[model samples]
Structure formats: C-alpha cells, structure tokens
Target: MSRRTASRALIAVALSVSLAACGSDDGADSPDSSPSAAATEVTTDLSEKPEVPASDDPAPDELVIDDVVVGDGAEAVTGSTADVKYVGAFYESGEEFDSSWSGGADETIPVPLGAGRVIPGFEQGIEGMKVGGRRMITIPSDLGYGPEGSPPVIPGDATLVFVMDLVEVTP
Candidate 1:
C-alpha cells in the first residue's frame, strides 16, 4: 500500500484509540495524521532571526528558536518552502506517536508551509528559522487539540511536543 494510504489508516486507528478519552465525537475526527519526521524536519530556506537583544522579548507568548529548543513562543508562523523530517510525542505521557522518516534517514519533503497541511502549532512555530537549523517545538493544547484530543495515548485536551531537526531547505 502507498505510504499515504498507510498513514490514513494509521490516523483512523489512532482516532479509535484516542476515543477512550475524547469520546466518540462522531464526526469531528480530523484526517490530520500525527507528526511525521518530514513534518518537523521542514528543512526550509533558513533566514536566521537577528539576535533579539537580551531584553528583546517580543510578545511574551511568541516562541523563539535556540539550538532547536523553542522558548518564549510567539504565535505560530509559516515558512516559505521547507524540507524536513520529524518525531512526535504526546505531551502527557511523553510517548512517541509518529515520525516522518524513521531510522533517521536523509529524507526531505518539500511542501508549501501553511495551516491546512500541518497542525496549527507547526505551521506557526517554525517561522524565521534558517535552512540547516535544528529546533524543538512544544505546542500548547490550544494550538494542538483545542479541547477534545485524539484518545488513548493523547488524552483529552492534550498538548503535543516535537523534537525537530531542520535538515535542509530547498529554497
């Protein structure tokens, strides 16, 4: 079967598993798949942010990238073109849920970075990163699940986290 098909099937299974918590919301199940290595690995054209002055804390909520660790998260932002791979874990249990490229292969997926293709946290988080930079992004429940989470591993209103390594950028 095609990888995409397999992924869809996995999403369906994941939803069922999550049903234990989010309740059978019936038709609210989103076709959104868990983060793939590629999703986080968006090795996009790197445009390094100018050093924020030590006192430079824009919106206290805006997240900043430092050595791949996200801090002071700003509202989510989108990249222009990204090639990446990623690994996802549930915030509550810290259990790995998905990855774009398993075994850390040098695989890159080029995508038009935006909201629909990826989760809101992701589409908004990796903005202003350089092409070959690696960063870890922690997404809040609101940007992640809102209120009802996909059950089982991801509890209701669960937050999600991703350890991403922006491997390359297609420019």
Candidate 2:
C-alpha cells in the first residue's frame, strides 16, 4: 500500500482501538487547568512537522488546548471532517510516536469529528480549530489511550502531546 493509504489504515485501526479502550473521563471541557506544554511555542511552519520539546513538568490531569496559529477559515464542529497534519509524541519524553508528516509533506489525515472516530482528547482538541490554524494539545492518559494503550507505539496510561495544523474542514 502507498504511504498515504497506509497512514489512513493506521488511523482507522487507532480510532477503533481507542473506542474499545476504557477509562474514566476527566471532563475535557474544564478551562481552569493549564499544562506546561500549553505555553510552548510552535516553531515549525504549517507545511512541516512540529518539533515538540521535552517537558519535565508533571503530566496534566485535564485536556489542554493551546493555539499556535489561529486561522480565519472554516471552523471545525461536531459534524465536520477535518483534514490535518499532525505529530504525536509522549508528553514527558517528547519522543515522537507517530506523525502524518511521515507519510509525506503533502499528506493529511481526515478525522471525523464527534463520530467516535478518534480519542476523546483528540476530538475535543480539534473541535474549534479552523483551517490554516495550528494547535498544541496535551492529552492526559484518561482521555488518550487509557490503561490498555495502543502498545509498542503508545504505553499504557501514557499521556500524549500532539501538534496539529488544520488544512481543511468539510461538512
């Protein structure tokens, strides 16, 4: 299979696995909590993968969303399908686990919002993003892979960090 096709396949399997995993919800809607990574600066261009720096701070207990670049294009909502380029890493180690950029610079993966097609943290994190925007999301384990995790790539009860660039949002 081509790299883009392979990447899409991986996303499908990941979404399914995340849906089947069980964990308590820490309520991603809370706005009071701030993670250290939320203050990080986004140094990469919209066309390239972001370089996530290692953080020594303790893992956050709630979902944290920070905008690196705000876009004036379409807003992502529950029914919207967003095409984005993203990099996923372990929050503590900053070790990259996956990246759509790995498929190729021209590649973007489509994520169906509010359709239970992705982890809660990811769904919630991308909810309000607009096309051309960039965001850094810090996902607590409860909202990510949970206790079972994805294995190999992601450890059990692991916190995750994602840097995403919204390319488009379509209904």
Give the runs in model 2 whose Cα sits over 4 Å from its true position: 1-39
- On residues 1-171, what C-alpha lDDT tens digit does candidate 2 reach at each position? 999999999999999889767443545453323334444556637865787777888888988888777778998889889999999989888889999989998789899998988899988899878898888889999999999999777889999999889999999
List per-candidate RMSD values in Å: 19.8, 19.1
Off by over 4 Å in 1: 1-66, 69-79, 151-153
Instruction: Give me the candidate number with maximum TM-score.
Output: 2
lDDT of 1 by residue, 1-171 (tens): 999999999999999888876753424322122333323443333332211111212222322233443223222225456665666675445467776655445655554567357667765555544455555565777777557776655666655666554544443
Candidate 2 lDDT for residue 9: 100
For candidate 2, the clash count comes to 0
